[model samples]
Target: MRVHSLFLYPVKSLAGVEVSVIDLDDFGPVGDRRWMLVNDQGEFVTQRKLPALARIGTGIDERGVSVHIPGEGRFHLAPGHEELSVLVWRDWMNSLIGPKQASAAVSRFCERSLRFVYMPDDTFRRVDPARVVDQKRVGFADGFPFLFANQASLDELNSRLKHPVNMRHFRPNIVISGAEPWSEDHWQYLTIGQARFKAVKPCSRCVITTMDPDTGTKDPGTEPLRTLSTYRKTQDGVIFGQNAVHQDGDHLSVGDAVIICPQES
Candidate 1:
């Protein structure tokens, strides 16, 4: 099988940026989920609560991120912002607070008091101890560094749904084509391009999947999740894709061949 696409969400919970090639570091993909939106209490805000975040656009360059909201103006987060402690999930993480103007602009769009923060190099946001095999760390992502989805699997889910949902609803970092439906469920190890990875766990489905990536509008029916639960329900939750961690190497590109190894018998 070959990699069909690569995506990076520089800021967690926003629409991701598709790229032809990605340079992986200790943090999986460079600039992936390194920034996040937080509320006054420093609690992380996401599309799960504020679907409007989906409309926020981010462009990353060597300097930093350029953020834009339609008809609302733009803001930027460059180096040398103030440091602040923000709460993500259960962890309190140290992050660089975006400028007040930028924060206010986003706050207006979100219709809440929000601040944008950037993950710094010194911070080590450890992955969940129970599921992680190695001493892996993530940025603002929910758990692992990478999330993988198979096209065939999505095809199967789409066949089940009355209105097919696109891949964007799932927000996988790596999209693999040419794999059998749900084949990733049996994969223990994989090598994509020069990078190696361990399939750590299955990603659970959530309400965020029901939100339209472009408009930030939610599907009243709570589809994909509602349908998946009937068949894909596990003790963990309704599941879809696999969460993974980078074992070694750097670059991954679209069309790179994928070599998989099933779990040992």
Candidate 2:
């Protein structure tokens, strides 16, 4: 199928930047989910706890990454370097032990126990499991580098919705056009060019999906998630999208053809 759009989130939970072309590494997009807001204890924070993160703006250029908040002056992160920094989400979680004292520190910024940290390119860190050799540096994603979605699936969901929704709501790294609606759900492995990705798990739906990336308004009271919940619900919860682990290193662009390999039963 054809790719309709490409997106990368330089900072986790903040708005994503649309790109004309993107380079794919082992995890996903090169710069996608590279930064995250953590608390003093190094715990992860997101819109679920603080919706205002939606207000943060981000831009990338030759100078590196730039972030803009309403009253706060713009902050820029330097490009990847040879040195490395070790930042952990678990560290931020431990800093929340002091009741309101700790909450106060974070509340000043947002409702969640979250702070911000940036990793230099030279930093060599392993994925959480500590076993998956993350030779390819990653930023702030839970794991994996890329998240791919099918345009046909979104179109089918929109057909069922009262109003048409744009691809922004789903926030995917890759969008394939030829596949059937939700066909990605059945994909066991996908090969795009020379890159290989294995569908490891079904991504659980969260409040973030309901919020409009453009207006930051909640609007998931419709089909797709609703329809998916009716049947796609796992024993745990309603699931959408597949989380993939990269098997090969390849560069992905706007029009790359994705080949889906069927699951052998």
Candidate 3:
């Protein structure tokens, strides 16, 4: 199989930036999910709470990361040094409260009070040790460093649904082509381009997937999720993709070869 596409989410929950190349730093993908939106209570919020977040697009350039509000305007995201304790899922860690203008501008669009937070390199959030033995770190992403999905797997799902959905629905970091449907389930280790990764676990499907990545609205029929639940449901929840940790690699490019290697049992 080969890499079909790649995506980088400069800010968590915001529309991701599709790039042909990704540089891996200490984190899985450079410039991915370093920024996030938090509620007034110092808790992180996402499309699950306010689907309009999906409408907020993200972009990264020499100037840094910027958020784009459709039909409104774009603003540069600048997080300051003021540290704030925020909760992402069950893990609470330190974060930076960015500029007030960013909070106000986005609040006006989402119509709710929110704060922009940045996870600096100093703020370390450990991945679930039960799934990954190594104490790997994660940013604002849900729980893992990288998420991989097979294109054939998506095609298999689309065939069962009334309306087809794109890869954005599941928000995978790496999309593999030429793989059999559901082949990722058996992938214990992978070498994509220069990077090596270990499949931590199957990513659970959620309501966020039911929300359209563009319009920030739910599917009237609750399709993909509705269809997925019927057959893909598992003890972990409805499964769609695999969450992986960066084992080794400096960079990843589109069309890179995906090698499934035997695990070191």
In model 1, how large is the Cα lDDT of residue 166?
93
lDDT of 3 by residue, 6-100 (tens): 99999899899899999997767988999999888998889988998998988888999999886668889888989999999899999988888
Best by TM-score: 3
lDDT by residue for model 1 (1-265), tens: 9999989998899778889998999888999999888998889999988888999988877766778876677667764567888988889989988777878888787778998888899999998889985789999999889999999999999999999999999999999999999998888899998888888899998999988889989888998889989999988789999999988988999999999977421
Off by over 4 Å in 2: 79-114, 120-138, 220-224, 263-265
Estimate the overall C-alpha local distance difference test score of candidate 3: 0.90
Q: Write down the TM-score of every candidate.
A: 0.96, 0.78, 0.97
Cα lDDT of candidate 1 equals: 0.88
Better of 2 and 3 by TM-score: 3
Task: Name the 10 consecutive residues with the lowest summed lDDT in model 2.
Answer: 91-100
Whichever of 1 and 3 has more lDDT, that candidate is 3
Runs of candidate 3 with Cα error greater than 4 angstroms are: none
